[model samples]
Target: MTTLEQLLDLPRFSDLEILSAHKNLERKVESVEITETPDVANFIPKNAIVLTTAMIYKDDQSKMKHLLDTLVSKDVAALGIKVGRFIDDIDQDVVDYASKVDVPIVKVPSSQPLGRLLYQMLSYIWDAKTEQLTYALDIQKRFSGLLMHDVNLSRFIAELGKIINAPVILLSPWHKVISNSQYFSRSDHPASFYIEQIDDHHYDKINEGNSSFIVKDLKGENVQVLGYPVNVDTYFPFHLIILKPEQIPYPVSEFAIEQAILVLTFILFKNYKVDEFFDIMKSDFLSQLIKAKTDQTHDHRNWVDLGSRYGLVHSKYYRLALAYCVPNKDNKTKLIYRQEEAAIAKKWLEAQLPLRIKNVIIFKVKNTNEIALLFQSQEPDANKVLQTLADELKEALSIQLCFAFGNPYEAITNISSSFIEAKSALDEATRLFNPNVVNYYHPKGLVGLFENTNEESIHYYCEKILKDLAYPNDQSQKELRNTLKHYLDYNCEITKTATALYLHRNTIKYRIKQCEKLLGLSVKDPENSLNLRLALELSESGNESSEQAEPGA
Candidate 1:
């Protein structure tokens, strides 16, 4: 860290004068060399100050110019000449050339020996190096002590910020804030400003290159951010970042950030593995509970014992719900069901659920895009809690989720019945083309009534009841069929039907009249309306089944 300007201030070299290139005195001097040979430039080290008498170039001004040019090309820090010895004074041409090229030239008097000057410069360098080494070792000890203690992730980040004297942030793969230091709150801008300024595209390049890089003044402020990737061997790893002010001339030490990344990688990876281990255990427990036989040989008490670990208790009413990822408008099915996102979704659900519904177990189904939940149904507000959870998850996941829950049962052995009912409700909702909504299993609903009926018989009954609407031949007939279906779904309320279908009330009345004319029956009659609703539902269900049963479906 010794500069040529600082060397001039030494006690032994206080009389040295700068002959040229005054602005270049700030260049660093890492070492010093004493050489009088003509070709010293070929072997002199870089960032070094060369001490010479200029005896070889005293007779030729061009040779002196060549020497200065060669020294500049080799990145020599400075040149000190022994004045009033072999050369009384430097040539004007040589001084001008050195100054023009920004090469520092120092004049040394005859009383000052080149050997003593070299010694002084090297001693300064050694002292600087020693100080740097001590600083690095201190940083190592402090950061290393963090691991010896059982500190959480937030505490670790806070300590890291204290060591570096800058704001630190730990980010997930999606650029969400996993944790941040207290210094972040004292910044001129909020955490969201920096998070938004994080260039994902730049991070992608850094990730691909597998190196640490800096981004200058992210939002046109005097702040530079350093992004260091942790656990690069994994599929998606966390990014450790530091925000430093621009007034600080030098960046934070590389050894400091490296030590932080090392300890943080260990902490984060350990937590991830622990979470993964518990997920496997929970999944196995649920699998065993659902697949267990309720025969006389198998004791039901053992089931309750195993379920107790996951908040499932004996004699508690529980409902089984199954959720599936529904396709979005952009056809993001390919991005859905990734193991990482599913894990995140599970954590979000666990943290966001209401405290009243505490006895809940959730796990991702094996080899499928489904999540299974088994929770107690003791509270009257449990349904409302589930609906709120579903809405939040759907928005948070950036994809649609359809949930179907079966009726509650008190016995652990009856979990299999609940699972079956949930599956049946999901399948029925899918057939009705309304699979994105939350569905509850009702044993006396229309779907449950016709669950065991033959597909051909259902199709025949549907066609017999609604003659032409069953298979529309034109757009007008299609609109009439859709309007009639919505009318019945809204309980024949013209206002609700219009709002649901986004149509005028008069249009709905006209469609109902047209349907009455075509079917030769009064839709206002209770029996006729009931039959029409049944036929419409059965027709839609049969068509959906037929399409799915096709070869390419």
Candidate 2:
């Protein structure tokens, strides 16, 4: 990683004259070689700084001019020629030509530096390689030690941030700030305020090179932002955001980012494997419990004990919540990436939710975009706490999460009922996609009725009950269906229904009369009203399903 200019500053070569092409001194030197032959271009590989005498030209200045072109093509790092011996001075034309080709041509102080220069370059390369290896080993030792001791994740991240004196943030695959790093430890505002300034395209650019990029402020202030991608060993579900030190020079900042990513990979990859093992076992147990396939021999002690070990306690009420993901355009293209996103998301939620809710068991629902968690709450206002937890999660990550809960299950053995209820709520939320999210545990009215209804049966029942009411001819006007539903919603109170619809009472009456004539049923009768309400629910569900089935949707 040391550039040619840095290698040249070996203290031994401090007296060497840097004559021309000073700007090219930043070229990185990989190795060093000596050449005294006229065809020196063929003697060295790319990034090798050449040490040679004037005998390299064989007394031909034309060949020397041509040699500069050859070195440029060969990708030579720089040329340090011993002067005042064979060739008095590097002629004006040669210096100009070297400058034009961006080749730094330096004059050696003496021809006797052969022994010292070679030793120095080799020493520098060896030292750099040693430092890199040592850094890698040290990172693994510290981070892995923490993992072994079950250290808090915030502590894990805080240690890294301190090592470099820079604020660090970790983001999930969908660009949600997961860690809520020390960057905001003293601040109340969300990470989105600062994160919004940097675009995801920055991630794509840095990832292309598999390295870091420093963005400088355009107004000439010394502020810089360093972007680094942290793949969980080729799984791109997260990235580490680093705030570049405004005063500290680069390569150091760059080196820190690189080193941190290595440590992160080591820690996360190992944890991922460990988490995968436990998740599979835990998920299997949950699945079995939900399906009533418990082991009868042990009286389900194994299941109960396993759940207890994972902190799935039972109190006055046990609630199940299923988190559903809102798929974006990019998620469709990268299935594996999307899966890891959900997996990492589950881990993130698991880590933080426990700090608030003491008794919770969180796990992914197996190859699905759903994450399920069961928690025990003893408080009288249990649902309030659950609702706030869901809201805070959505706001903190800035993610659109559709949550469904199951009504409180008193017995742990009957928790399967809660799972079924939550799943039903999630499915209906996905279909209706209304309110974009369902905050509560229970589904009501038409949404609840069509929870598991088949598409054809729903359409059939609506068509039969509503007659021509379901098929509104004017595409923009869903007037009749909506009006009838709202009328029944207000218990056939014309004034209340009209105000809710933002229409005149006379208009609402006319629509109801139209519906009565079309369906051959009056809203005044309780039996007829029940059928009308059921028809409306089916009709709405059918319409929603149709939208999802649209060609380009």
Candidate 3:
């Protein structure tokens, strides 16, 4: 992992001058190899620093040009040539091309033997490799001792950063943060957001054979992310990311990451049975909570054990937050993909919830495309925590989600009430304003009011209000009535109705007047418009026997 620049900075080579430098000085040297002959097609090891006398190409310019092109195409680290041997000096075109391509050319003093020079470069690289190995071993020992103290994942990952002198982050395959070195804050550019954009195909384009790479931190910054990629099979693909990669010793960091991966895999396997039990508990607890069964009637010990097993610090207050992944029907999502997504989304939230707030338990609602989280948070500004969680869901999974949440409640038996409220909020919000977002229950929402109502009552009410308006037999009149509905919804604003219907303002006004004449309702009056709006809503939605009847029905 020794760089050409580092080699030049050595005391013995301080006088060695760089005649032409490569565009990239950070290219690592694999080894030093001598080009025995000046033939342009000679095999060169990748990332090798090469030494050539160029005695064979003294009289032939094309041969010299070919030689330089061959080295550049072969990905040589840099070239060291004894300038005064047979060729006095290089042509301007060759030097310019070398510099432009980032192939650094070093001019060796005439007295220096090519044999000794190549040996010195090899010695430097070997010594660097040795030092990096020792550093990696020290890092492994430090992390290994943490197992005895029962340190958490956050501290374990943070120590890795301190040892390497780099900002570290651990991420799940879905790009959810597992643990990170607190040395860096995620407020500026979320790494999860960017990494989620790079899928497996993109990885193939950028990653080397060993699944490690130096890619631009998806943040569109000048920073290069050095990542050691590893997938934890069914759970998630994960890896270590080094933010300040300039401080990274590639050999040491990569080696230590290998050790970390091994340790983590072993730890997960050791807890595999407990994890399986927790998965079952998640489903059972979620079902009971949805049914509003508490310690009073059914199994009190079950709830207590569930919370204790998962390390949940429960409080009196509980709120239901759903990370619901509404499928993209246009793209035709498969059933298997949906099921896997539900599970993965569940795991993602489970990992992140513990980080943002205490007293949280997450559940994967079976047969539904949603992950439910019940948080008993003491944080005053907990809505911010919910917003952050919602953002992470979108970034980590790369999907649109409705982060619908309910108001906090005191009793565990009232969980079903909160669940219903949260669901109603999501349904109404999606129907009215935005598609993907956090939605709260609105008492005025059409669905919220009629949640307990049956379809028969709603249809009957709509038929009574606007019988003829409901069935606009004539195409033109039907269009007019439809416009009137939107017009009334927009508070009879001609401009808004026109914009919503993509029609002219005058057309909207004419349509509204036609509707008023037919339905016997004034478009401008609040009283008439409210009744007409309710009728339009009832006609559009199915009937329901709600607690509150439709106005004027």
Candidate 4:
């Protein structure tokens, strides 16, 4: 489309001077029509630049104001007046009125014939249309040719930016930048500024497809940006964005963007197809590796082969950790069962893991709520690395995750043992600490030592050591048990125990003596305290097992 500003640059309209509404010079002019009568405003079309000599309103300033008002209401593009032929000059009041109503008024040369002016304006508009058509076809040809080569997504985005002379960015479904054009780095502001300014509703509109809009930048200045949704294989969706600079007058070529989207969609679809196959292989390998046994009689060739392909060497020390989502207690009914959040978290973890810590392999555990990570290192820093990773994942995904790590093993063949240890550690960590904790397997710990012991023996031993405290038949007995546990936790320090239980020192001493009398042993003795702690753990574990075994637990 030909705009008023573009028409002003033509040689034929070189003498035309804009008298008002200079800011609206970019108003579009689709056709030029002559105003023959005072009521011509009623017949003029929208976006039509009107040509008139002011013959009907030359004598009456009020009549000129009325005509200007009607033309503004009709949404006319502009008014071109032959100043000398109708009146000596346009009245100052009339010019001010046109400016207030945002109607551009140009002073047409008095000697120029109105009929010839019409022909020139119409011819310029037709020629502009022809040029735009040609530009569209050229955009299609250039972008379509890029598809013939096996270019990647970044190359496609760079080409789009070059053709449009604007910045381009491709974002994942979760709104993370996937690829960006070089123009973004050369700008005064980073591409992130524009990405952050776009509202959520705008993304939603683009997700539904066929949408374009202008949004404000970080400085709240109007910036035109176009969004296109690129859905790959109907499973992964992406947002393709174009930032139109204010200095560029022409609208971006839609055909060019369409071709780019088509190419990007194909590339991503192909990538996902290959990724899907790779993921299947990885999943199968993980299952076999985790289930392999140390027995020499059993066949272990499959895990060894799979491990070799995935960079798992037999000689390197490997530590395994399992990560899973912990639903909010207040909103347990709204668990993250949807694949969207899980996919985003998994992708973020995969990308951020190598950046933060090296020698790591991350994969989905075939559960929407879980991921498995294997780290190869001889240092005892895997726990810290996993904790840092958990913290970053929580911050980035806004979802709490618990990480349970297994003891490091020197051989890849023993990865199955570490996996089993991780599974047990996860259960014990959730029960012993908070659900969202990062914990490692300690084989010498109380829970680890007796985790496989007979349940009946554990119950019998717990009851024999603590007697009434095991069952806590009365409130006083329960208080004594709690005070004893606290006292033991505080390292048998009377003052600390008193402070922890919020009781006087004398009361704590009396409670400890009563516990010793009931158990026939010194409550503060090191051996007795260790036994009591173990008994307490066994009692809690038994209760938990019973509760879980209950119907509909």
Task: Give a tens-digit lDDT track for model 3, residues 1-553.
Answer: 6777778888988767788854567777878877757653467778888888777767864455566777877788777777787878876777676787667777777888889888888887888788877876876677678755666678777777776667777766665577787666634566565465555554443234234434455456555566665544533446656666678655664566677766655554445456657777776767776774544566454555555765545568878877666667642357666665666666666766677777777776655777777777656755676667667676645655567777777876667777887877777665643464667665656544765578777777666677676655666655765777677778768787677777777777777777777767676887766767777776664322122211220
* TM-score, per-candidate, Cα-based: 0.50, 0.55, 0.54, 0.57
At residue 21, candidate 1 shows an lDDT of: 54
How far does residue 436 in candidate 3 sit from its true spot (Å)?
A: 7.4
Model 2, stretches more than 4 Å misplaced? 1-16, 21-27, 32-47, 50-77, 81-103, 108-230, 237-267, 293-306, 378-400, 432-438, 441-553
Best by TM-score: 4
In model 3, which range of ten residues has the least summed lDDT? 544-553
User: lDDT for each of the candidates?
Assistant: 0.73, 0.69, 0.67, 0.75
Ten consecutive residues with minimal summed lDDT in candidate 1? 544-553
Model 2 over residues 1-553: C-alpha lDDT tens digits? Answer: 6677777677766777767755556676777888777677886788777877767563765567777788887778888888767777777777888888888887886655766777777788778866756765676677768767876556778877766667777776556676745756765555555566566567677566544444434344443566667777455546777665543333343455566677676666777788889888778877777766354554556555667766766466777878776666656577776676567567667766677666777877875868988877744544455556556555544445567878777777667888888887777677663444545555465556665768788788778888777756664336677777788989999998777766787888888898788778788799888877787766764453222111110
Residue runs of model 3 more than 4 Å from their true location after superposition: 9-17, 21-27, 36-43, 73-75, 82-88, 108-116, 167-230, 233-254, 257-276, 286-324, 328-340, 347-361, 366-392, 402-553
| Count of steric clashes across candidates, in order | 0, 0, 9, 0
Model 4: residues with Cα > 4 Å off, grouped in runs: 8-17, 27-134, 165-255, 294-298, 325-337, 379-402, 411-414, 420-437, 441-553
lDDT of 4 by residue, 1-553 (tens): 6788899988878999999855657777888998758788778778899999888786786677777788887778888898788787988888898898888888988888889999999998888767766787777677667767767888888877777777889987656788899897777877777787776688778878756688776678788887888986343468888877443335444554576677778777777677767766877778767766645544647554556676665456788887766655644565434354455566667777677667677777765456788888664665576677667666544566778888888777677888878877777766643564577776766666786689888889999999988867586787778778788888889898777666788888898999999999987677888899989877864332211111110
lDDT of 4: 0.75
Write the number of the candidate with greater lDDT, choosing between 2 and 3: 2
How would you encode candidate 1's per-residue C-alpha lDDT over 273-330 as one tens digit per residue?
8877887887877767777654455554488777677777766687888876555445
